[model samples]
Target: MPQKFALKQYLPNSSRLVYGCMGLGGNWQRLPLTDGDIKQAHAVVETALEAGMTLFDHADIYTHGNAEETFSHLFKQNPALRSKMVLQTKCSIRFADEQHVGRYDQSKSYILKAVDASLKRLGTEYIDILLLHRPDALMEPEEVALAFEQLLKSGKVRHFGVSNMHSGQIKLLSRALEVPLIVNQLELSLLKHDWVDAGTTFNDDQSKTNRVLGDTIEHCRLENIQLQAWGSMANGLYTGAKIDSNRFNDKQNAALLATKELVTNLANLYGVGKEAIVLAWLLRHPAKIQPVIGTVNLDRIKACAQALTLELTREQWYQLYVTARGQALP
Candidate 1:
């Protein structure tokens, strides 16, 4: 018999794994952006729903808001699919150039306008989940609270969260906001294990740049906030790099080969793909991490769905961690 699906209560009781759609409509140049591409993207959404994925993730800055438009077009084509799934989109972070060099805005005016435009682009009555794509250094807690209250009252958004923020940031926002901030999406993977190492200090300044693993995860669990992991594949940093590739170095290549071997072995044991095993490692954490996967390929979507079923043993989990870090527990 198939194993029962595990669901985490993101809010009071709503549960979803949250599929990231950053590559779907937003990064059209990298993926496809035409009307035909939009139609094909819808098929992936359908497949995800069929496989039990109920939450769709997006951001306004993604492909300069083209992702939301693509989703809107899909909703227009199949109006009924709206009721079957939860829609989540993010705001903040404006870009002046296509290279995405600009400012992060949390001003009430920009947020309000951004949400209105997002709703219009999504062709939806309400966004099930809304997140601040990134924190603004100039954000006023009271102003954010007021904006969230207004949106909640107007039925424009049902829930709120943040992306790429720390515990102190979440605390600051929670103090003035009445609505519960249900999630924090960040980068987490075996290769990026700082979330698990909490208070441990790394001497290498370069490694320290990205190391916040242990404290962030612990704080989220204590606060009843879900950890949504993006770049779960480390942006394919370890997939496979040619020896001459810029990203490929002796140390990095060794770690990648080790991870590839571990993932392949687990995939065979679980009857899934290596990618699924990679994702499963994140799910295996006690912090209740829900991976936000961005894929335009249907086979990849199916593989991701299968990942929900693969379970890694404790030894196997640590093996990958040790191999990636080239060190055992301290």
Candidate 2:
């Protein structure tokens, strides 16, 4: 049988590269968005769209919810653009304020309210996919399931998923959910390879013996849930001049310089931008990891799309992995 929430099921022509809209909205300081902010967002959206990237990833708490508000300007300018893309936004993150500390809320009331607020901000009646921003410590599975059921029945959200979740939590939530959870967005990149290290160094007693995310990856694969990777570019760790500074500690900077050298060599061999090479490594996985890139610069955004077409060989992939990990396989 086919998987319940395959990428193509919702996004047939979706780019393997998902665009993160966190940079669209201005800073989170509550200042009014300037005309330049809108213009930058417009250029980013236009660049991504032209590069065939249609799946946009958003969170209600991004830039204090102004990110979605900023993106709405695009649709307002070209209303038809709304139908041309697959829009996915997240809820459940309650920002910190005077009244309450920052926390996660999966309660029925909060979930429902967050969805309505996100819809209003996006200026859309329905969301393509609605993801719970994070796992709530006090989450009542039945209450969350009820909210999802109502949202689906009311045509407010089409799909459901979670971020930063593991297998045990997903199973606990799935028991009460009539709809299958489809996506797990994780913080995965060359620099942050905990997800891969645990598997590669299994049974070894090095610094990377936690193996926490191993079961989560296996469960997602078995359940046919798509894995979306955030921070896919690693905050430009390998982007020129960024790693050449003297501020970092000796050990840390030394490791970075080594990895940057390896990345540079691979970039030359592959004849593509370093960002594409980095993203392509994630794409080369059998799990079909979809990387969400957060770059707003038009040139970098377009450069990242190149990962969709590039293919890294098995040896090259492992080489990049070993270099990034700064150690050899056991």
Candidate 3:
């Protein structure tokens, strides 16, 4: 096995599993951080480090910026940790206020200001990777390129990336930038399987139902751009997170239950926890898709880390896929 992940192209010592900071801090409220929130943050950071998750994912809007603020406490406690970990964050998402409706902003000014705020909140001098959280329909590639160049030269950001963007969008944006977009994060998991469906469901009836459609995985693979899976665990639907069954239809419910059963069986066989089996399914893919796990629960974090060493066979990987899809391949 190689010593580093595909992300190593950009983040040399990055982990296969990124510790998502979306769940950090107590709440999205503007209130000050309570002692309980600080305690939980410390615990999750320590557990993530022990699990070999040295790369932390953050967004400026996570918890209304409280997540990054809370994470800064970790570095304050141990300044050395700043050097030990690679911190990746995002911007370009602005929530609606009284005067303006919520929207995406990729303008040069917005990108620059957002990074400055993220740096201050993270208490870090430089961001390992800065991703545009989402694409703005009105984004100008030249404008974004200018912002990225300034960020790089100013020593505020080391590398750049994008989230929730398709290949064409990334390609178009990259054309104007001096930097190679190093990462592309998307919603990919057993529960939300369209990342794989783009290849399988084409020229067939199943194509119509694919909402988040794109050949992004293939494009990223070909370009050697790291593909990070957000919502990789399906909010724990398959691994036993309590969810209201009301949201799923009959077929969806059946598939969820069936996938859960198969994951459990495999977990016992692999001698690891169910979380590991679930994540192992993602890691089994050739894309080397890094799973950004956001579970703040200590045991769950440890369970997910087990996937670092677990490798699912081809058959097992397909079994989990079909079961989660709620239908067999065409």
Candidate 4:
């Protein structure tokens, strides 16, 4: 039997890369979007499409919901593009306002309302996937399941997933959900390095306090859940961003420099840009991780697309891992 919500079942043609919409609506402020913002967004959308990246990851709270609003312009101008795209947006993380503190919401009412608002903003009748932006500490699984049922039945959201959640939480929620959760988005990159550490550090002292994302990578893989990576480029830390050496200790500084050098060497060896090498690190994982990139630079976007074809050998992958880990693996 096939898994109901597996990535292949729903997004068979997903480019294994996602264009993050957080950077689409301009700066994080209350002001209205200017013409320049929409123009910039068009470049990202068009470039990403050209690169074969059809999934656009968004969130209800991204840029005060302006990100989805901005993206809707493209679909409005060309409705045909909607059929060619897979739109996934997140909800639940709320900003503080005059009446309430900023918080994570998983209440049934809030979930339904958020979807309606997001649908309106995106100008779409349905969302290919709706993810919870973050876990709610006071989440009630039964209520959330009810909301999911409504969304699924009404054809507002076709699929569901989450961000920043662990394996146990996913299991608890899945027991109540009618359809399987298909994705888990997280901060997985060479710079963060904790996702790899969490898997390798079990039974070692390093696992005691260092494991923030406990076995999530393994759990997602075992469950056949698609893992999408955010911050996968590490803010150009390993690629080309100028480092502030003063902020790191001597050990950290050495690791940073060594990793950057290795990335450059591999890029030249592979005949592709450095972005491909960094993204390929995540792609090399057996879990088929999809990286979400936010760069709008035309050349840089194409450079990132190259990762879809670049294959790093086992030796090179471990070499990058050990250098970034800053020490021998446990």
Candidate 5:
């Protein structure tokens, strides 16, 4: 275990669970937003706020930029809601259309322009935190620092961070910036255990070689960068359409089934939703990771909020981990 980074010190009353706004804007490549979609967004946003989810996660490319567009409707309805929430959005992931190849763009101009677009769509004067959506292969750290400095000076963005970035990349960018990087968003869940597995198997041959998270979890702790996990529910392996997908191999399928069985038993024992157990698994980690759940269903949102109240013991936590991993620790 390492020193903890408390988010409240930075956000001043942020929630443990972040509501990922990816699902709010309806479908991708579809045009002409419908009234039902707007209504659903309102309902989901209201539900998350009621559940104490102050941090809303968004990306400029989410639903082709309509997630933020749809969420702006809430502020349009009640402007006061703006003061109650901490808004965070990401930029730099450009989709591949006929005109340009799909790639990352951390260039100063792109970052600056993207933030302005996000602010306009979100209908907010300032974004509480702005994150680079993913690591740009050609990123100029100094250029990125310039963008951060300009945004900070203009009072458009308060803090800066990165998503899907390793410690080396974060370090490079941090060196060029005056402000501290506060968050590192990554894909972590009961199903995605590589981050923990790397540490446990650090010096062993049985350790996975290619799946290393580059000491990211520990690095984040040492640097006091809060980790925010996306895809934290494992793409609904336990709660949604498990049988229909061909994404898993035989071994992975077996692990998934065993993990589901164990989660179900524990879920019943604790008298909480299955989602809570999934989220609780991450919350129990010393990192105090904030899981960004992408479901727009009100009931499911409330179920995830239950994780804040439930705590798993050390033995129970390891039991779930071993069950999900399909093997005992080496």
Candidate 6:
């Protein structure tokens, strides 16, 4: 029998894996998005659709908003393809350069204006999912709730969620909003499991600062908020780096090698690629994770989409985790 795609109640029953367009138009350093690049990105989306992958993820700050523009350009040229897919985008996180960064904005004015800008750029009236790009310390939950209410009423946005927020923040926002915050985009991978052992007295307080993965994962399940894994490939830390580099020191290199071996074995067994094994590792969790893959390469996109069918047994999943951590399971 053919494999079936898993669907979360929050998003329309689309593909199990979502294609992230952050790196499509250009890189993050405010590079110019060329016509050829745009065409290539369109081809990636077309290929994804042809493979039965329909969900596309984007954000206003991605490539300084040029990613959305590229998507809009492609959708305008191929209008029929728009209805066949589910479109999602993010807002907030203002930055002029790598140094001069602006604070997060979740006020009614910012949210309203941001959605309008996204709508114009996406060339669509309604976004399937709208997520706050990051947590704004000064965000007024009531104002955000009001803005979401208006968007829902105006048919501009259908669902809402957040990215890189703690459980407390998500809970606070839920208290003030009537709509369910359906998803939380987070950083999760075998090598980046700080959230898993965050509060277990690892080394020092500084290392524990960002270690809230367990809380965030558990809370999402309790709240029925889907967990979306961003940086699913660990920003190419596992695949592209040299094994002898200082960054991937002896211990880390050994872990990477072990992971590589496991990935290779699983890929051959599943008739997929190593990238698919990385994604399958995350999906094996009970968190109902949907990986947001950011690959401009069409082959990479197809490889990631194949992860939807690669299933890992419980013991194999734990073995990968142990290999990544360079230690036995606690």
Model 3: which residue pairs collide?
A: none
Model 4, position 138, has a per-residue lDDT of 95
> What are the runs in model 4 whose C-alpha is more than 4 Å off?
1-6
Model 1 stretches astray by more than 4 angstroms: 1-16, 26-33, 97-101, 199-214, 237-244
Candidate 3 lDDT by residue in tens digits, 266-309: 99999999999989988989899999998999999999999978
Which order, best to worst by TM-score? 3, 5, 4, 2, 6, 1
Q: Supply the TM-score for candidate 2.
A: 0.94
Q: List the residue pairs that clash in candidate 2.
A: none
**Alpha-carbon error at 323 in model 3, in Å?**
0.6
lDDT of 2: 0.85
Writing each residue's lDDT as its tens digit, candidate 5 over 161-187 gives 899999999999999999999999999
lDDT-superior candidate, 1 or 5 = 5
Per-candidate TM-score against the hidden true structure: 0.89, 0.94, 0.98, 0.95, 0.96, 0.90
lDDT (Cα atoms) of all candidates against the true structure: 0.76, 0.85, 0.90, 0.88, 0.88, 0.80
All candidates: CA RMSD in angstroms? 3.4, 2.6, 1.2, 2.6, 2.1, 3.1
Report the error of model 5 at residue 190, Å. 0.7
Predicted candidate 2 versus true structure: per-residue lDDT over 1-330, tens digit per residue = 221235776567566789999987889898777777778878888899998788999999888888888767777888998888889999988888999999999999999999999998888888988998888999999999999999999999988999999999999999999999889999988888888887777888763555677688879988988899999998889766366466677766766778788878877877777888889888888888889999988888877877766788999889888877767888
Candidate 5 clashing pairs? none
Model 2 stretches astray by more than 4 angstroms:
1-5, 244-249
Decreasing lDDT order of the candidates:
3, 4, 5, 2, 6, 1
Clashing pairs counted in every model: 5, 0, 0, 0, 0, 1
Worst 10 residues of 3 by lDDT: 1-10
